[model samples]
Target: MPRSATDLLDLSELPAPQRREVRDFVQFLLTRQAGAKKPAASYRFSDLCGTMAWKGDAVAAQRSLRDEW
Candidate 1:
């Protein structure tokens, strides 16, 4: 509920280990924010979509999959 960084935490009053935990949490937030600001990596599945060539009978394949054999 703190409005500013200075008011956000009393790191001085925290034990050293707890202070380190806060520092780590802040670092994680910063890194997460940085990642959010950037565009995500893209993937191109189109190139691999139809790369495999099927030589068998198409209708037979469909029927077999339906347990219609």
Candidate 2:
């Protein structure tokens, strides 16, 4: 019953090709773990401030809408 990675694997005893395969697998797992820990990009309302094209006067539109209510 191996309690740790070092006890579980004796890299020096493995054949060269098998050792390379193990190393590649370890690198893949490490890369995947690092990618998982990264935070997703954050968004802000300010980023969308000028994205839309307004066709009419905003204040006048609001007033008209209010009058209709």
> Which pairs of residues have clashing backbones in candidate 2?
none
Task: Return the top candidate by TM-score.
Answer: 1
TM-score of each: 0.53, 0.44
TM-score between model 2 and native: 0.44
Candidate 2 lDDT over 5-68, as tens digits, reads: 3345789988999988987887788789889899987888767885677899999999999999
**Counted clashes in each candidate structure:** 0, 0
- Residue 59 error, candidate 1, Å: 9.6
lDDT of 1: 0.80
Question: Which candidate wins on lDDT?
Answer: 2
Q: What does the lDDT read for residue 58 in candidate 2?
A: 100
CA error at residue 26 for candidate 2, angstroms: 0.5
User: 11-63 in candidate 1: lDDT tens per residue?
Assistant: 99889998888878887887899899999979777666856678999998998
What's the CA RMSD for each of the models? Answer: 6.0, 9.9
